[model samples]
Target: MNWCTRCVLPDTRPGIVLDAAGVCSACRAHGTRDEAVDWAARAAAFGELVERTRALDRRWDCVIPVSGGKDSTWQVVTCLEHGLHPLAVTWRTPGRTPLGQQNLDNLISLGVDHVDFTCSPLVERRFLLASLDRFGTTAIPMHLALFNVPLTVAARYDVPLVVWGENSAAEYVGDTAATHRLDAEWVRRYGAVHGTTAADWVSDELTERDLAPYFGPTDAELEAKGIEAVFLGEYLRWDPEMTARVAAEHGFRARDEGPRTGVYAHADIDDDFISIHHHLKWPKFGFTRSFDNLSLEIRNGRLTRDEAIARLRELGDETPYDDIAKFSAYVGIGTDDFFARAERWRNPDVWTRRDDGVWTIEGFLVDDWPWS
Candidate 1:
């Protein structure tokens, strides 16, 4: 709720720190760019990685599972530029937003042969509803869609190396442990909890069991096959600004025309679900979806914490109409249940209860709800 005096980040951001002068570390780092980043060296290392990794057997030098976001585009282009025969994989999740589908289509048009993995919509819907009801969220398959599906495909097809768009800790947040450099542990403990983020708000339908499908090789499996999922950001210094500029030359657009931080910069792509969730988290955790991005913006002095928070507050809960209707129908519940759960998780102060014993928005439930 409170903006940091020195940086463009608000106190709502988790694990934020302020110096005596009220400045943030991102601001401090800005002063040391010459020492912090060596773009030439980074680019060279990236080239080296492509040359070296591609020299490996060529069964599939590497695979980049892409959603065709700015970052993914960069990753794919870089893989080719580096001389790697990279196979692209895309998962056709049920009810993919139009913008998301467009992004995917654009990615495929780049002449990269891609394999789309789409599962049973009924099964996906059942799990999506279960997770949404239990966790007050509909974006439950995020973990599986992002990590598991591509990984499973890689494993089954004998692809040894899988490349990800970016690494969170080094690019976005400060996880100053020595492991910040690309290494084995980066893959092992990539997350804080079981995976993804916290358990506070997830879809209930997607159980831990659902994740078992994507867990990439047992130690035995990885060892026997030498399977490695690498974060391209590591080893190569990640320059989001440069990545965006180049991606634009190759035709990248922001999904929402909003500020594309982190992996986005091209001014058009899908911003509703990811953007809305980040905006919602503002009042609760005080950070947007892309924390490192906010930090980067702060370091560069493009944004102020007050401005970020205010902008975040201005965002609305914009769910696509078809997605809302289909998800509601799939859950076998009306849209009321979906809205009620979402309102409860987002801003508890807005859920209104019926004075006449019906659930309505007559009043926000913050003061009335037991959870508050």
Candidate 2:
């Protein structure tokens, strides 16, 4: 597979462009939009949002869901500086990486009060396993960590307004999903299912027959409670790299301890893995490492077209088999047949059909987990 000549993303991605010089359309599109955004104006707009939200109640003025990633850190700092007494909320997931832990600590050190929301370790483990079993991903906790608990906590505290760092599709990923993206919908669907993810993993333990009292959403909740969720990045000029630099200046250090090729996520933050998982799942989707390396090259500015191709050829056939096993064990499945089932989910075209008739994936799908 070739990286889009325009932005360094892969050409296989539908709607992405590939030019002769090996740039992708995402890059070109971003270039166009970047020129139009008045970042200071957007920040002014954010201040207005803060003011309007604060005027809504005497309850905790605002709630900022934070994982201490650069964007979250920036949001919290902005909230605190605005003199809004914000409640920092986080969902502690299993395998919270070392850097993630530090980011959380830093948030505490910054003197904002926070609620540490966590699940039983066993429950977290089981969920990871279940995520692997059901969705082929063990990092499902990271995906769910940002949602659910916040609203549940909001109801308890009666905190009506919540600020989030950014919306993936609208702000950073691209604008295809932007026109109709609604903030209220983001609030409702954070924990259930997303536009891009499956719903069964988190709710699997609850039997449909028994979940009558807990159906996903109740319209009455939104109509009366004034529960408002806002996306900070959409109306603002935002760049992850720029945010990272700002975060570093504010004492947010890189979790220098994790993987280089794959993002070693901060202990509990959600940003890195969401990007990395795409790479893990890409091979399963028939795209190769071309898509993975290209993004980095775009970010770092070293990704030549030829270099991307060579790297894909060199890296395409790897998988995370050990991660799959650990994820399997965490969820309590020990059968060899399960791995076989997982193997079947691999990128159907690139995964191997072994001599024994069972399928084999790039060893990286869940392979070579140093933690295990």
Candidate 3:
């Protein structure tokens, strides 16, 4: 539960490394981007990639997996602004909020041809509940489909390129070696599913064929089709607030108020269950969305470390019980069962209960930075 010297991230976060100086790997990674990366050169390389993909005999130059959130909208606009035709693809989350649906439709209003893929609700519910029951997070299936389905569509449409958003390794987690890779193996290991494959989720009721959409193509198939997937964030600087502003100009809307659990008004707005998913991180990882959002702001130089720490203290662990109740109803589980399952998933290495019955993490509440 040691905190990063430079950001609000805890050492308990997976793939995070705190150096002897106490700076976390994510802060170190951002330092590399700021100090060494030549954005002009990267942009040039991206232009070449766009040209090569556009020359392929396909209806679209690339497939951009979108959530109709600010980042996806920004990705679509970025492709269009660079003269690349992108086919936007969305794997619809089961708990689609009204605003989520409207924002998703906004992508179409931007004049791009869009495809929405939905799973059978019965199967999706079963998978979601199973994920909650086993992994303590309901986002496993959604994460799997988010990364897999777009590539499947790319192969089906004969599109040679798939454009993804940020590289989590570069922005959030992983060692320096992973900062620049977007290969299937890298994604399979560190992407949202966090090494949990669809094979791990197969059950008596769910067959291989039923889970095909969640399974990405084999490496040979992807290579044979000449599919090249790249991260747009690597080429262009990624600032969530900036992207939200840009997307707002293009008909995207943010939540009227900030979400119950996080600082961002626009992020994760497409799914009502996202807040619950983020809230669960507190018990499991000792930190949650506030740490993530504030870290980004810290990296972007928008907030001082003190301000970020204050914000995290004020808002980080506030659980959105309403969102949790919604998710429980969606998965046909009781609210008590939901909390019981959440408690089961808490990492004892990171969390302890006080006499007052409040959960807390050790070595995380810093009175000041630059700890000696």
- Model 1: per-residue Cα lDDT over 1-372, one tens digit each: 444555446443444556677665445544564477686786776677667666667667777888766778888877777677778987665545576667667767776778877755655656555555455445545454556566667778777678886666544444434253333345335442223332232346444454454344444665577667777776555566767766666777654555532223342244333443334443345244544455566565677655544444343222344445565675576877766665555433433445664433222211242221
lDDT of 3 by residue, 1-372 (tens): 688888888888888899999999989888786667788998999999888887775889889999999999999989998888889999988888888889889887887888899988888888888888788887788888998899899888888888898787777773646745367777776876868778877879778777887888766888899998888988888878888998999999998977645788888888888888888887898778878888889988999899988876565347788888888898888999999988899899987777877666656754432211
Residue 95 of model 1 has an lDDT of 46
Whole-model alpha-carbon lDDT for candidate 1: 0.56
The parts of candidate 2 lying over 4 Å away from their true place are: 1-3, 11-25, 121-126, 139-142, 176-205, 208-220, 257-279, 286-329, 333-339, 349-372
Error of 1 at 288 (Å): 4.0
Q: After TM-score superposition, what is the CA distance of residue 211 in candidate 1 from its true location, in Å?
A: 5.6
User: What 10-residue stretch in candidate 2 is worst by lDDT?
Assistant: 210-219
Best candidate, TM-score: 3
Off by over 4 Å in 1: 11-34, 37-39, 133-140, 178-213, 236-241, 255-268, 279-283, 286-295, 304-332, 343-372
Number of the top candidate by lDDT? 3
Per-residue lDDT of 210 in model 1? 46
In order, candidate lDDTs are: 0.56, 0.56, 0.82
> How many steric overlaps are in each model, in order?
15, 27, 0
> TM per model?
0.71, 0.72, 0.94
Can you write out model 2's per-residue Cα lDDT over 266-372, one digit (the tens) per residue?
22243333333444454455453345435545545656556655555545444545544554454566647555655555666455666777545444322332211
